[model samples]
Target chain A: MVDQLKPGKSIKDTYVFDLKMSERGMRINRLAEWLNGAENREAFKSDMDAVMDRFELTGEEKKLILDNDWLNLVKAGGNIYNVVRIAAIFDVGLYPLGAQQLGMSYEEFLETRNEKGAT
Target chain B: MAMIVAGIGTSHVPSIGAVVDSGRQNTPEWKPLFDAYEPVRTWLSDERKVDAVIVIYNDHACDFSFSKYPTFAVGAASEYAIADEGFGVRPLPPVKGDLDLSAHICRHLVYEEEFDITICKEMAVEHGLLVPMDLCFPQQGEWPVKVIPVQVNVLQHPIPTALRCFKLGAALRRAVESYDRDVNVAVMGTGGMSHQLHGERFGHLNSDFDNWFLDKIESDPQAICGMTHFDLMEQAGAEAVELIMWLTMRGAMTPDAQRIHRNYYAPMTTGMGLITMQDAA
Candidate 1:
């Protein structure tokens, strides 16, 4: 399903969030979107497995969330913004998540940025 | 009669809002970006005397999810809530809306221009709108100017075309002018100046493409009007496609609009670009 949405010409590491990706990642995306609510964040923090069960996330989806695999979550059709919400629960920011996705330490990623302090 | 006094094109990076909220504007890393807006803040409030703003921005999966996303959504509510995008909501007051003006724009777009925009009575504005507002306006207890939120779907695919977004701005101009009340409006195009945050190409920044886009958006928007989503994503990363929203602001102005102020800063991942324009005298 995720492979179906690739454009005729593809960027090396970019993911285009299309209808198919949206449909495939609906459960995880919806669960992440719900994290916008404070109560929902708390609910997930405590008994996360129950919340995952309620959202009916697949075993792989559960593993991605538990394993802190930001890149796989995105590759599995999770929208980047929705994935950011899930990562925020663990106090991970967009920069850190990107660093992890790029297989670099946060400091190494900061060195690549023009304004390291901007983070 | 209502008039669009000016148009502002800016990057609505979320971190800017965080800096403003945390009182880190004086810090070296952010001072330059915040300082650039000081003159803009003064100009809009003092010189232009803008009463309301039409903000063209995209929802970053905050308020409206993929479940039911509108390609083009216009806010017709009396107020808009600041969205909590995972982090706590920014320390800002609710955005006051100009319902009469909003309704007027909505009616004109549908009836006269034939742009079938979704009318949102309850819309929660995220960084796309807030960051621009934070940059251009100073808030006392309440915001200085009321807003009419115009949300474009730049997140998901099959979103509005660049031409369509521009046409929406043209329709918005007509909508604003058709209103009977006398009001000065400023249309703000917020988001993008090239930066991606998705995958291995996460830290993409194209200052050259950003500069070229700024030049075209000001001088020959027609050149950009034909840009395909693939072209934009290829040149400037995928998320930078949000630059299309800026065309909506350009489309609202006269073809010979005077470029008043221009600034570009690429200190971080996103190339923060700003351009202010006014209709030729």
Candidate 2:
């Protein structure tokens, strides 16, 4: 979970308009470059489908998707940084949560990993 | 004559410059974060008037691997290149290494101090060394001083204890002081304030622990001198507690010294902190 340093309600309670553009901001640019590629675009299309299926998208997010308006996602408070990073990582066949998400035993994952490598 | 100038402790986070390039530093949210380091960069380059720097940092699964990792590795090469780090080379000048001075220090540590450290004749200095150099010695086309990089094995399991690192720094001071050449040496210990970059706890940031760490490093390093790996990992983030490297810098300085520059910022899951102390003598 993202460690929220404060208590009480969320954004509406502590909304600050201070936008932070990171020097490492190129991560998004690079991700966009890949997302434009045929292979990455294909992968992201499926991942987007999975995200839509798994999580409830905000009304604005759904409209951005329906209209194919990429910038609208940012306006929805869904920072492109998160979307591009998660998508890129998924495209690389690497899951951020992995089996750990299910709370599965690491030993079982190790065995499966070894079996996959042997194959 | 031997003259130990000052001690510096700073974070060598891989993403600092990348964060800046991403335009984070320009925003009001992160401008104060970047502004603090401006003085640190100035002090290391302009005021120190340093001829040589002794850098202490650990490699992150680069250079040496888990197969057979040495606790302490000292470079004896005339010149070192920036490490690849599997991603790509960073934009920076080739790091200049002082071969003669490194050799003398190695010999002194081995023979006089009876300390056994792995001698590295051909080793590429990683971003750990490069980041600090970039921040401290910017503006100049190249660094004005030569470098001596001391690689530590803190990534892998069963790494050296905090006390061992402290003693190694003390040994390093003797090695520098014994050098026949008349050169002023500055020691830099690079690592963490409080951050965990890998695994599920990846974005962990502990500013309170980072500030407490900065205070302890200056006033009573002994508080953290002999901490166990488990203890460091417990209080400090797993990836963070590596601040044990600071003990080495503290060990290099005299018992009493005035802390000149100190700053802390937790812009992005990593507590970017820096402290500079003038030698008491």
Candidate 3:
């Protein structure tokens, strides 16, 4: 069924946040979803380890969040949007996270776009 | 009876909202994009007199977490709170929902159309719905029109297919037209043109594909409906598959709607595009 949906060509370095990925990233995502509240955000920010422990995030998952590895987080089944929430707790915004995911320096990433520093 | 006046398709990039909120819309880099929407705001308020908007957008792990995300959800609440979205709650007013119209549509979709949408009472809208609202209606204090948010799960896999999205739009038309109300409603589809924000392919933008999509959505929606999720992701980037939401707006319109205004801008990673159409009279 899945193969029927695929085209002849495929995209590299692109991860589709599909059902398999969603199931894989459930724990990390649950922890990230809690950030929607101010109190939860503060709790995560104040003591990252405690919050991670409470969420029961695996060691690899904890490492991904700690390393600020946005790409790896996605690889570990973390949806990009939820990963964005996790990144925010560490004061990392989407653009910088995207830069890290692409293995580009922030300056280099900005240079690739039509409107640089517009946001 | 309620009437469908216009259909709108726009990118709901989060950065666009940040630009508007920060009052930097007139800056050289952002002016072209912001200026494009000025006429849309005027058209909705002055020309269309749109009393309500059915905003078709995706919730990005804000209101519906991945734990139990629904494939399709409809907001039946009287008011929707603005979500924090991790950074902080945006300094925006709560969105007003037309409960009577929403509940009617929800019932119609489930019983008559067999869409089986999850009905939401207390959905906190994030940038997906709000950014498009900001684009089409730059409000001062209160929004000019009430909104009925139709949330789709575009982030997760096993999302409704392009054809399914288009069919939902068609069903929406029936629901809107059947409502015995003296109101003009606009259907707004918010999401991508083309851009990827994940993996090594981050910052992907395909202007050619985006432009093609804009044209096809207006003239030949069936072509778009024929595309699989993989086809869209392969050609337009993984995240660009969100464009399927636009079909919901297009499907609600007449087969030969008149395209009034169209604009496309690839400023950052996303190919920000806007197209407005009115059903043929």
Per-residue lDDT, model 2, residue A116, is 24
How close is every model to the real structure, measured as TM-score?
A: 0.97, 0.70, 0.97
True contacts kept of each: 0.69, 0.00, 0.87
User: What are the lDDT scores of the predictions, listed in order?
Assistant: 0.90, 0.64, 0.90
Tens-digit per-residue lDDT, B80-186, candidate 2: 87755544456666778899999998999899877789999887766677777766655256767888989887764456678778888889899899888888888
Candidate 2 or 3, higher lDDT? Answer: 3
Model 3 reproduces what portion of true contacts?
Answer: 0.87
The clash count for each model shown is 0, 14, 1
What is the DockQ score of candidate 1, to 2 decimals? 0.60
DockQ-sorted candidate list, best first: 3, 1, 2
Error of 1 at A91 (Å): 0.8
Assess the local accuracy of residue B42 in candidate 1 as a C-alpha lDDT between 0 and 100: 85
Clashes of 2: 14
lDDT of 3 by residue, B1-281 (tens): 89999999999999888888889889899889988999988998899999999999999988888888899999999999999898888888899999999999999999999999999998999899999998997678888789999999888777889999999999999999999989899999989989888899988888999999999999999999999898898888889899999999999999999998999999888999999999887
lDDT of 1 by residue, B136-181 (tens): 9767779999999999999888888888889988999988888999
Q: Could you tell me which 10 consecutive residues in candidate 3 chain A have the lowest summed lDDT?
A: A1-10
